[model samples]
Target: MPVQPTPGTPPQATSRQQADSAQRVELGATIRRLRKERGLTLVQLAQRSDLSHPFLSQLERGLTHPSMPSLHRIARALGTTQQALLASAVRADPDVTRQAIRVVRCGEGLGVPNVGGMARMLGSPQLGVHPVEYRGAQTDFGDYFDHPGDEFLYVVDGEVEVDLLTADGRVVHQLAAGDSLSYLGGTPHRWRALGDSDRFRLLAVQNATDPLTGTAEPHG
Candidate 1:
């Protein structure tokens, strides 16, 4: 006969439950680190990801877990992919020596889901600069972005109209194939494809870390 557990003793966690708890803790730490690296407060991250502040706080504390969609939103807001985030979380030592040269073959890269299209990461996170290729079908005027470091955009194909919101007023620019634009950090901007083309392709490069010093301006 097997002996019963002591009275009032709580049941032990199963292996699966233990594994899940470990993962949650790791993921939460990774999220918090990435947020701080981007100089974002929990509230700011919540706003960017369209997630509730309380939920994000709980997630960061490892008291709660996020769904796949929620994770994707967080990844997008942090300017990273889900795979990269997960890899960072699971790695024993992130500071390990990285490969001197990394190569991404044609049509090979981490694909990130976008509002009206897809974005692929062409550069590794260890490079300190993120190079992304965006292919979009529908125009997205509602998607405005502002972040901590400078950004450069090159139109690989098709045309796009960009609106930069400066302190004085909004400035607009029309870009076509072979055209490029660069902007300082913390500038509010939005862009949409021009013409009736089925899709447009753009190459964007941005700093992966916060380059600004002092307090960061609140993003509207």
Candidate 2:
């Protein structure tokens, strides 16, 4: 009797190929994250690489396929060679499904919590942030300074003063929730929880390397 492949079971070769396809998604995400982290907008990247803005946006959004030359150009602009991207893509585990992301409490997981002490991990670990809580007045907020990315704030509850700093130690802007601010990330920054109330709550979303990315605060 001739043997037939099981209806539910994929052949080893087919499985291996599928795994490769999955890695493509991860590679695409990495590309987008790196691009955003560099604070280079699609328009800027296009200008730098001489690529069309639409095409570049599609590539970053993972909606289109980028040719080797195009990828190479983008890589050059990002200051990383194509080989590094390729290596990362290759090292990605095929078993890891990109769509099955889980939302965990900031302090619970090995991730930075955003505002309200809650971090919603969108789809990938690379795509989310949680609320960060700053306690005490005049607190230095160690490890809580300017970082290499942009960040957004949403005041969940309570009150706090968020101060941004420039190279010259000047306060550029200040805000309290119900109030929000967006600024170039990674530039020395600080915040203080204000109000005579017992709780000070705020949500901060910055580049994944914001150091605070892995930490979470409790919502009052």
Candidate 3:
């Protein structure tokens, strides 16, 4: 037997369900904004991602959610990464003062899902720098990320390998704990955790604007 609601009582959503609904709406808005930034229509994006236009439309309308593979395809089509898309959907502090000077306590920040590891945003985008802390288990060669402005990475623990795709060929660099690296923007690069422990922590910082001209660039 099941319980039924009273005639005048309205159905209510759980907190988790409400959060999911909000995230869905934010993600849809992000996708639509990115598509418009690239000057792409729904049909064009569908063709680029090999997904159906109707499905893309539904996704943008927040009526549907995309699977991991579908999301990867969409991210690739948008010249970004799945992590970037997820991070963009995360709700930041609405208060301007909070955004200006905020401190993220341990284990407290915006979490990004399904990026082959655990990642959290430690800084707000309003500060002109996006800082994310990544904890990885096992060696996972994630997708390459390329965006405007400069990027910096610091190894907080364990070891990792970074590959930079250059005009001539791929350049690989092995880094241990306390090691750091910096590179110009628009350079394709990817990284993976290493070592027998199969665990590592990395801090990645990227400029939110062009370093040379101080112009805003695409997030993530």
lDDT string, candidate 2, 1-220, tens digits: 1124457775764554454444455557767777788898888988998999988766555455554346556766776533334334432453325653444333221111222232222223333332233322342343244334456776666666666566767664445557777777455566655564336555555443322232322222
Candidates ranked, most accurate by TM-score first: 3, 1, 2
lDDT for each residue of candidate 3 in 144-219, tens digit (9 for 90 to 100): 7676657899999999899998787889999999999998877898887777434688898877653223355654
Candidate 3: lDDT of 118? 66
> Which of 2 and 3 is ahead in lDDT?
3
Q: How do the residues 81-191 of candidate 1 rate in per-residue lDDT, one tens digit apiece? A: 443454343232222245624464554444445556666656543555657788873576755666555789999999999899988889999999999999986788778
- lDDT (Cα, 0-100) at 177 in candidate 3: 93
Instruction: Give me candidate 1's TM-score against the actual structure.
Output: 0.59
- TM-score of structure candidate 2: 0.38
Candidate with more favorable, higher lDDT: 1 or 3:
3
Ten-residue region with minimum lDDT total, candidate 3 = 10-19
- lDDT (C-alpha) at residue 46 in model 3: 98
With candidate 3 superimposed using the best TM-score fit, by how many Å does residue 8's alpha carbon deviate from the native? Answer: 27
What's the CA error at residue 45 for candidate 3, in Å? 1.8
Backbone clash count for every predicted candidate, in the order shown: 0, 19, 0
Off by over 4 Å in 3: 1-24, 36-39, 50-92, 95-99, 137-143, 196-198, 209-220
